[model samples]
Target: MTSAVTGRRRLMGAGLGAVAAALAGCSGRSGPVPRLRLATGPQGGPYNAFGRALARAVAESGGRLEVVPVATAASVDNLRRLDEGSVDLALSMADAAEDAALGREPFARRAPVTALARVYVNYTHLLVPAAGPARSVADLAGRPLAAGAAGSGVQVLAGRLLGAAGLTGGPAPADERQLGLAESAAALRAGTVDAVFWSGGVPTPALTDLARELPLRFLPLDGYAGALRERYGPVYTAVTLPAGAYGLTGPVGTIGVGNYLLAREDVAVSPAGELLRVLFDRRRDLLREVTAGVRLEPRFAISTGAVPLHPGAAAYYRSVYG
Candidate 1:
């Protein structure tokens, strides 16, 4: 639980007030404070848990800052909210952030969003009934599938993988439904959906609960990592969900996508700096809610790939790296 992030006395050229605030974070705030909204994911998801945890940590510190967590579709939805200034901070997948930054398919134009930190990796999960006839991604050609919630990173990745498997835009495309993780789990339990696509930290609470309640099987996605990386970039990685995760007897190979904390281009330096300081200083407290946060560290946090870091984040990194 100790911070691997050590800082030198040098301010890394950041504004004096900003760097001081960041370093002095966690002290209970006095009176009025700046309120910032953070866009997280749907209920029962990692983003939601992390957002609430961060808010609580800041609150417990009695800081002069207030962070509010807003539930959304996650990833792309978060980025869109950031673009419109509806939210000051957001949690997003690196891939979706890249797509939005580069004006990719779902995004007609580039978005003005910047990174705060690389939080963790999301392990893609394609779960089906254990005893169901469908055994592979291709087997669900004509079946009903929960393709993730609307405007979510899960849906974006699911579409690409499904199209590559020839399950979409075919003679009998999979009937797709836009459902969030909780809704997808409910739909699967009701037998209304044959398979559900979820991309989040391993042992996502909802998925873990679902696994224990109903026998479930994870479909292997080991084959598409290379293709997705080739077509897109290094944002995709081949990772395996080890045995015992979700109480599974065997390992499941899947695609792992980087998750990032981001902010709008216009976010001021003080709020951003204060948040970063609190994040590194109080990360262990965050892990009580989102276990994936255990993976967050100074060095790893700086690797946001194609997305540029916010000015405050850059300063924080410089202070640590120096």
Candidate 2:
């Protein structure tokens, strides 16, 4: 009986030890997840809206992500941050992405950044005071124009468009006032600026408000659209703003480019995949959250040409759309 009792105690001890070991292993191992930092544009830009939606989706998907609002100059700044590893993810324009990847335009050297997906298209809007003499892109010569903030994607594109129209340098050269959207609107109202160049999604609050309060004219870029595409390649395409998009008097012809999400090459594939999955899974929710994100679709997401897609993102795309 004594021997039997001793054996039973030994058996109990071994079983308890095994259970504890199993529990320890379970505790030691954790699901593969990574914390990510997403870089967005200025406080009130379309990029901010997109970033917020992406953050909410990642949170819902049980991934650790923190969207960091960055006051950048748009696409150019986004690429620079990705190249230096300062940001794990960023929002960029497709044209700028191409330029950075190919070491063209502002990029002195090729940047090592890849795309997660293209998000939406941004239209180039040329807004003028209703009573201003600048009836078209050509009328702006020798007038003051808000070309967007310095070092911004808007400024780069605005400069190119102005140059192509032969309105950059002349006897009465158009002066570019480097200002944010809000400031630009104010300048136009005060008659300090004759016209403003903006590249963004429709229903822009500042421009919309300006149109509602005062008479505004949106100059058509009809003749120069083909020329811009020829010079800038396929990244630029002709886009039209419908009559009611911003309470405009009529439809306006413009040139536009796509927006894309970017990530560094070093980020893990799993987390990237998870990020893309969350974004697409809750696509409707995101669209309701922000009007700009409403246009995000699987077809547009895979249409990037400037920067290569992240492997994880590509996998997610293939899984859903394939």
Candidate topping lDDT:
1
Highest TM-score: which candidate? 1
Off by over 4 Å in 2: 1-33, 64-67, 287-294
Q: Write the per-residue lDDT of candidate 1 for residues 120-173, one digit (tens) a residue.
A: 788899999998988889999999999999989999999999988988886999
Global lDDT for candidate 1?
0.82
lDDT of 2: 0.74
Q: For residues 3-75, what per-residue lDDT tens digits would candidate 2 score against the true structure?
A: 4235323333444334334223212346644667787777677777678767867767655443455657667
Question: Candidate 1 regions off by >4 Å?
Answer: 1-32, 291-294
Clashing pairs in 1: 28-62, 29-62, 29-63, 29-64
TM-score of each: 0.88, 0.86
Candidate 1, residue 300: how far the Cα is off, in Å: 1.0
